[model samples]
Target: MAAGAGALAPVPGVPSASLHEFPYPPQTRPRVSGGSPAGGVPPATDLVLGATAGCLACVLTNPLEVVKTRLQLQGELQPPGTYPRPYRGVLRALGAVCRADGLRGLQKGLAASLLYQGLMNGVRFYCYSHAEDAGWTRYPGGTVAAGAIAGAVGAFVGSPAYLVKTHLQAQTLSSVAVGHQHNHESISGAFESIYRQHGVAGLWRGVTGAVPRVAVGSAAQLATFASAKDWVCEHQWFREGSWAAVLAGGMVSGVAVAVTMTPFDVVSTRLYNQPVDADGTGKLYRGFLDCVLQISSKEGLLGLYKGIGAVYLRLGPHTVLSLFFWDELRKMVQHQQPPGP
Candidate 1:
């Protein structure tokens, strides 16, 4: 039977004409059809695994993010008082963080990152899958629309955690500076401090820029991924495996997101870290227009994309891992399902 099945399968070097059609033996079809139950793995399982992997990666790479943020936020555009650049690039930054604050420094905002990513990716994947299932996949712009909505919601839900994380990551420098003392040491500490000082509003300090950035970036990512996957599948570039589709899709998606959202990302980062007093008591960015004007006037047009390289660095691996792992997890779940509805 195995030998017969092999004979019917597509030749190893030949490209299949259609993706939906498989050149497999008739007997194998029954085995495959009988192995899995209806509905296969729950969408939530994919969410859980993707979210876990995403959060883990974020925690591991956060030191790079910290260095990137500091580099972008430098007031002088040069090292302060000849402190050996404070943090140069990824490796140098990691070394400095480890040297100064020990291993704990590398994990400065780990808790907040985990919490934020878990919520962000969890909702993102869940909503995206549901959108695909609900005939949204058939629409012309459905992928982008679904991704925009998912990202906007995720950004809002995860904003508070992000605020805490950014503040904690920034706190280390405050201690070293003269007459500048930071009290927050942990995620809870940062949250409490922000709430105590600025109430609920403080926790959402950067919502204006953040919302648009996430929406645009997410739309670009999903649209690019879907389009790329379709193209690759049509071209028979990597067999019929979902992992190959994901890899190709993720590369295009990462590049699209990074390029499209660069300006908004810079604005969002600054808005999040800016001193509230500088903009006024309650105004985070004095409206988006004013924020743009200020950044342009003070820092120049280049300032709008300050840390774009880091964005690529972080996003490349992030999107690749996310999409690839998501496909694999889905497959595993399908394989494990019982033989019933």
Candidate 2:
């Protein structure tokens, strides 16, 4: 789970008392043949591992990501639950997209999605692992704040990729002309066009919104994953270090992430994709709070939770795969290292 800036308020229902326990055996920290300044394995190991896991998961669920983006951006100004809106819900939205543009429509932003995930999670996991190794995440209390800081750093770096991804996903001819379908045909082209049009600042269009979204998501995900896995191990729910424990912990994390992230995710998508005039003022949302207020008033509370199904589908398996892979990689690293002096 995400780990150590400020105290992360306890996740409701998880006992605070036992959250400090580490699930894995505590071996003495060892020196490395090639390592970071810390004398242990370089934190870049986590970066590479996270990117591997993120890119792999992105390929599998890009369709869901595309669909989820569309769902969030769809019907923004339209009345809640209204038909004649291009997309209404999961099944209807999926059918509408396929019928209009074919299955390729759902894959609209796959490239950007993969690139963004690699950039974002690479930094995210790298930062979190460092904090964990330093014992910042020795307890659950600091997990969320730690994740927020790491998430913000990663989001800032990857904002352009995410902006491109959202623009591609939000494209539909019917409604939401307020949101643009970019003319660029490739990822590089998209990046170039945005830079040429808006300069360096243009590429980071929604970073303000993205930072909180990712921070909350990372914290909710990693903290719960670590705690749940530890709890499962303590009770012998599954053999320690087994996939079963990993999967169980990941599942718990998915729910927390979904609940914490959807609102901020919506804000990030809108801020990123909303069309701006030559002067760069958003036509749809005045700002993040305005977007939430408008959505809440017009679409009701459920508006905040749009695309939740697609979120769960994408995030659940993603959390499972990434955590499982990261855990296994760490175990392998520990295994290969000689005993600490």
Candidate 3:
């Protein structure tokens, strides 16, 4: 797969080929150099690159994240049409946040967000890239499995940060507040409070919801991204190595990821931000499955899709920026390495 020639245009009147027949455009292939298989990055460097990119993206898109979280939790546990929705849409939610908490409101939980994104994507990219370097992704279905596993590991490692982030983001003023507000003063305060109340186990209280959200999201995002890139190149939509192709592929992948990920995302946010009993058990949800069942039965199926627009708005750009930055950084590092004999 790495030894491919330049992009091969589909033959006139011929059907597009499968990824099995063509894994990547030549320019997109990792060039083997020195002792690095497929010009792969060092494991530590891959982690840094992924974390750096994810954090950068997180900083820019966190406002949408704030809005999305609030939107998801706006009418929590209420039947449709039963509750007055304070945040009816993305724009309305943004306005409500600004009015209630000022511009800084949009940046709530930034510290926890950065921590989560750093750990999660760092581990995620590290694992996925290493799998590719090992040729484990050459097998059919390997890419999806590798992406899912990487996401699960990353999500678990960062679950504590995410738990704190959810609570912080959901901490709005009474007028615009939604969900079970934790009233966290800051990331450190949230962490300290949870640890004090429930011990070490409290920090990971919502990981059950987080794992599937990230795993499904990662699989959809990565799989679609690779296939979309190949499809764009095969269709001659952009020149090899063109930034346009990368952007196009990212945009396509973002839609797939948003559709597959939103339900899980909504559930994860609810789980993390739900109030807890003294024993550290969730007050509202016993576990992930119970949460799903309650949300479905009480709020209807669309409850799981709340804040979908905000989710897409945030996720699409986040996906594009993170992947683009990660890809460019990898290329830059690969170029710096000396070639093999």
Candidate 4:
């Protein structure tokens, strides 16, 4: 049976001759490079490149993330229409944050944000890069699994940074800045404070929430990007590896990620930002299930989708910038590699 199945299996390295043969084009089709290497490992250089690009993109979009976090956290567990949401809409929320917290407030967690992005995306893109090269992305389900594993591992490793980033971003800095404002002055300070207050465990407060959010988001992101790129190239929509193809792919990936991941992202923000009680338990949310239940019961079903627009806004540009950089950088490195035997 195994041999029979193998005999019928499609050759992953072959590109479809026409649209009728394959539902979508694969940018350049699978290559000899897609064959399994002895170690099945991607280069360390790709990981570093992914991290660097992610850090740059995170810095560019931190303010939007802050706004999104604030909006998501505003009416948690409150009944719909009863919560006193300070920020009205996306534009209003942006303006309100600036008005209350000042322009700098928008970029509250730059350090933590960069740190999380570096770690999270480093692992994510690294894993996807390997998966792509290994021909795992040739199948839709394989792509999601590869992305999910990568995202889960990355989110777990980067949980502490993510916890800090959420905390710093959620704080609504009062104009007065008086009476012990929640100011995360530095990453070290944040780490030290959380450790002293909640012990070592506190640092990774909402890893459970983060894992699914990132995993689902990453899966959607990588799969959609690949498909979009393939579709564009198959139809001659854009030159392979060109900025145009990258941009189009990123746009589709960003929307798919935002739509699929928003609810989990909302939960993650809430769990991370919610005040920890004396027993080291979340005051507003007991756990992932509890949070979901409370939000549904009190805030209505839409509560799960709060700030979706804000999520899309941030995710779109972030996906574009990071993928653009990664693709361009990878192409450069590939060009520089010596010819193989």
User: Which structure among the candidates has the greatest lDDT?
Assistant: 3
Per-residue lDDT for 109-146 in model 3, tens only?
A: 88999999999888887787677666666566666777
Q: Give the TM-score (vs. native) of candidate 2.
A: 0.81
- Cα lDDT for residue 104, candidate 3: 97
TM-score of each: 0.74, 0.81, 0.86, 0.80
Per-residue lDDT value at 13 in model 3:
25
Q: Which has the greatest TM-score?
A: 3
Candidate 3 ranges with C-alpha deviation above 4 Å: 1-38, 229-245
**Which parts of model 1 have CA positions greater than 4 angstroms off?**
1-40, 43-47, 76-85, 89-96, 174-182, 226-253, 277-284
Sequence-dependent TM-score of model 1: 0.74
205-321 in candidate 2: lDDT tens per residue? Answer: 877788888878876765666666667778888876666776666666667777888888877888888877776667878787888898888878888888877776677667666
Better of 1 and 4 by TM-score: 4
C-alpha lDDT of all candidate models, in order: 0.58, 0.68, 0.75, 0.67
Candidate closer to the true structure by lDDT (higher is better), 1 or 4: 4
Please write out the lDDT profile of model 4 over residues 165-233, one tens digit for every residue: 877777665542211234667778988899988898988888888888877776666456556655677
Any runs in candidate 4 off by more than 4 Å, and if so which? 1-41, 130-140, 175-182, 228-249, 335-341
